[model samples]
Target: MNMPDPVAVFRTEAAELFEQIESGLLDLTHRLNDKDQIDAVFRGLHTLKGSGAMFGFDALAAFTHHCETAFDRVRKGEKPATSELVAAVLAAQDHMRALVDRPTDDHGDIGEVLLARLRCAVEGDAQQPASVQPNPAVVVAEAPKSGSNTWRIRFSLPVNSMVNGTNPLGLLDELRDLGECKVLVNTSAVPSLDVLVPTDLHLSWDVTLTTDQPRSAIDDVFIFVLDDMQLDVETVTEVPVAEPVAAVSAPVPSTVAAPIPPVTMAVQAPVAAAATTERETAVSNADNRQAKAAENVRVPAERLDELMDRVGELVIAQSRLRQLASASMDIQLRSVSEEIERLSGELRDTMMVLRMVPVGSLFGRFRRLVHDLARETGKVIELVTEGETTEVDKTVIERLADPLVHLVRNSIDHGLETPEERRAAGKDEAGKVLLSARQAGGEVIITIKDDGRGINRDRVRAKAESSGLIQPGAVLSDQDLLQLIFAPGFSTAAQVTNLSGRGVGMDVVKKTVEALRGAIDVTSQTGEGSEVSLRIPLTLAIIDGLLVRVGTGRYVIPLSAVEECLELSLEEDLRSRGRSFISLRDSLVPFLRLRDLFRTGTKPDMHQKVVVISTGTERVGMVVDQIIGDHQTVIKSMSKLHHDVATFSGATILGDGSVALILDVAHLVAAGQQQEAQVRAAG
Candidate 1:
């Protein structure tokens, strides 16, 4: 078992904390009055500062301290949480991430600039409003009781306390300052010298003290290491004897055996009689705080990835076992194989669930994008999101970020109009961008819709013709023309701007989607709006594929794309040599002959099979010799040299020890569309 590097763990944790803080701040910017979001942001910052300090990130701790203090004020209602304040903190959060990532690197003037903004946010440029002084009576009511009480303290420093620069002596010294104190080091579990690690603390402590300070003071002593350590404290009765005596020598009372109600009695008896009940309630409050502080658990991301890898290997092993069992004649072997198959299927399902994460995380990022783009473009834009709870594989989510950012930028910069323009067009001044995600037929469809000036098809056609991307008077569908926007160096924008338009982003989006084995579709109407949608596979690791034999070589078609399989009659096959079209349910579906397409010099089977497949409105039939059953395909990418081959998306290994190329559904569908157009043109 390899141990994680503590420093690396700290860096990872700090990065996640910064992201959570940034997300909360961005959300609060939209709804300033949302107390829950304000408190959440405050807690995130508070935890980050404490955790940084615990991990010996002093610079990060100190930097986060200022932001935490500001948020604390907001949480307490001493200062109102405002957009300007959230923006300032968001900027500071980025700097804090830099500090966590490279503590030794010089931040230069970035820190100074952010600090100035924070100060301005904290202290508005105008004169400060008169400070409302609290009533003296209320202050008295909140003051701590003045009396000595015995405290039984039990605590264990975190396992890595010493290495993290924490000194247990400091806590002991603070306890000693409270009054008479007896500290006993418990080393009963300390290992032998040969087995012991010097850097790891193996000692805990039991301390008995008499103090006049409130219990909160003791908690403050361990606040920095609270999350990583175990601590228990209970107030005991004050010694009956007047003078402070040695705790070891003091007589034990049965009343102190159980440390709860008696501790409540000791603190409140000396104060007003009614204060005893309040002190009991305060003890419970302290327990609640400790419970919440202990609830957080951190696990390394690599551990999850390792588990996924093991699951994948298990799936492959199971596939091999199933293949061997089916080939053998032993009934018992087949039975065991069946059992293993069921278990492996269940394991694969579990692994997939583990890999899936809610798309809400991806949705949260766009809030900040919209905020900044609104400011930069000087347009009032409101972003609406739906179906955020849709779950997709983590790998898919990771790759989708950049393309989504580009789409959003294009929507704001090019698709959406300025507030003045929107109003003049009889639309709402604030433009609306709706981003949504939903699962449909093994694919996650993410749509980005904006109500603004739609794409100009005439301008696109004109641009394509001028650039020689298309013939000057060539006939084309509106959808085809719109797709030309994805071509390199093609832009319909009248003027290029910093945000987008030198024809760069959309092409990248197209390439990226294709690289992920996904497809993109665009729809727009003049003066209405534009919607761009991406259909990406739910998971890239595996798929349910239909295996077919093409000229003794096997090929797998995505099961999601297959509609039906039909046997070609002898006369129909002989007649359709030049043009292959199958009649299925009174509809003429064009077919591709795999043997001819692959240039295989083999004679066709007497009865060939036509597999009908469709993607959206386009349908095609693939001619093959045999229709094999459904297969659980573990998709492996093609070699870089063969990456540009449009005929196959990926390759998979069959149970019979043969390689099968997974047909590219989108590409074949496009080919079918071309075939249909040519046949019509000939007619």
Candidate 2:
């Protein structure tokens, strides 16, 4: 097996770390004093900086340090987390991502500009003035006589600690900061040169100090290493004047017999007890990390895709075996076919679950998008998200990102009103935008809603009429009219701006969503807000379909969308032939005769079935000659030559090896609506 390139691994992990940092910063903007968010952001930045440097991404590491430093200041409470600082860090994160992605590319002076802005934000927050002073420096002008005392601390760090960036000398230096101090090195544990590990630490320390500070101050000296290192801390009192010479031997240790100190030199007893308590906690944390590392392995996404392809081929082969088994009378062959079919299905389902990832991964990046858009438009926009736990295929998530970006930008730039406008409308000064996702059977619905002035129907109508998209007074339903916004080159704005009014985004959003075999729905109530929903399939690889035949031609209807199938009586069908509807449950449902749609040029069977399918709450029925039962449909893309065929989403192979087209529910529904509109118009 080939090992993955370490650099590539770092970049992938770096992306995730950047997302965490950006998300933490954005969350901090809403609650500036959230200590948890502050610390989380700091850790993310710190980890990213360290990992980048380890992977030889020097520029990325260098750029990320400024951000880490800024968050550190906030984490330490040296500077309050301010909106300006959060925004500045958010911007810097973008630059860091660029550096991580294209490390060798000349970044020019972008880093300096972002760093300068960060510095300004930090300094600006610093200028607010302090209310109270903190602890003074470690070395003070000769300790005050009233509270002067000494502390005796003996500690030994883990042997491998020094190589992992812990400096024993640095810890000792901190101890000296308390007051006048003397440190004795204990090196008895050192092995002979022949048996020694040169990189390991084989020594410990004993420190005697005098200071006016409290006992807690002594603990502060070893704050970073206290949990893992062996440290014993206790206050040492003054020597008796009467028996000053006796103090030297009062508590002398058997291991260290030579000691001539002004104060008493005691054996390490009480200090050892304090260290024992922390040892268990340290050991437990180490064990947990080790277990976690053993349990998980990081594999590249391409490998998973390759595995899925192999599974798909296995499924196709199983279908062939089933067909052969049914024709032959060999009991053994039939039994083997059934076994393979069962195993292949189990494998396919497992592969699908592996491909399914939570939509939260996609929703996270939008927070940053909303943050930047609010700044650019100078609007007070608050983003609210829901249904984040909904999951979709990884491939679908990747493809939907750009289209979702366009939709969100359009909402912020076009649908939302400014603060003044919102105020005039008696709404809150700040506008709100909601992004949500949820699963309905096999489809995942992603919606973007904004509490701004809704679609201007009159303006849309005018633009559509002028652009020849519709007649001047076309009698379109509210849903139909809202959709006109997606027409190419359709814009109702009086003037063009950088953000919108250029007649661009909405149409491209439609195209992209449709390419993914998804549908777009727009609904708006004037002055209330507007909602745009993209309903997409959970996966494009394979699906459970209801295979049916109209005349001699066959098609697959996604099983997730099928609600029920009922026999259509010839009298009932003929009674509603022109209207193309069936009265079921006392409500009229529009029906399409597949025979007519496909132009099969064959007569319909006496017993026809109406398969009721839905996209959201809207249902349409398909009139078919036969219900051919369920199939494990492996979705194959339409060739570019037939890519524009709207009636079919994709084609698949049947067990008999015949080609069958998968119906595009969303498109067919839209076509049914359009067909209904045309019939009414003629009437």
Candidate-wise lDDT, in order: 0.79, 0.81
lDDT of 2 by residue, 427-526 (tens): 9988888989999899999999999898999888888888999987878898888889999988777789877788878888889899999998888889
Candidate 1 residue 203 Cα shift, in angstroms, is 10
Residue by residue across 1-683, what tens digits does model 1's lDDT show? 88778788777767677778877787787789999898678767767776677677888876776787677567656677777888888888879988888889988878767776776686666553368432321211122234466678889987888886677876786577556677889999799999999899989998887766556556655655665677777656654445445542453442545644665566556543433444454456567767876995556656767776677667667778888998999999999999988998888788788778788889888988898788778999999999999999888898899999989998888788998999899999999999999998878999999998998888989999999999999998777888998999888777888887698888889998898888888999877889999988888877888988877788899998888888986678899877777777898889888888888788788898899887666799988988878888878889999988988899987765677999988888888778878887887
TM-score between candidate 1 and the true structure? 0.80
Best-matching candidate per lDDT: 2
Those runs of model 1 whose alpha carbons end farther than 4 Å from true positions after fitting are 127-317, 576-579
- For each candidate, give its TM-score against the true structure: 0.80, 0.80
The best candidate in terms of TM-score: 2
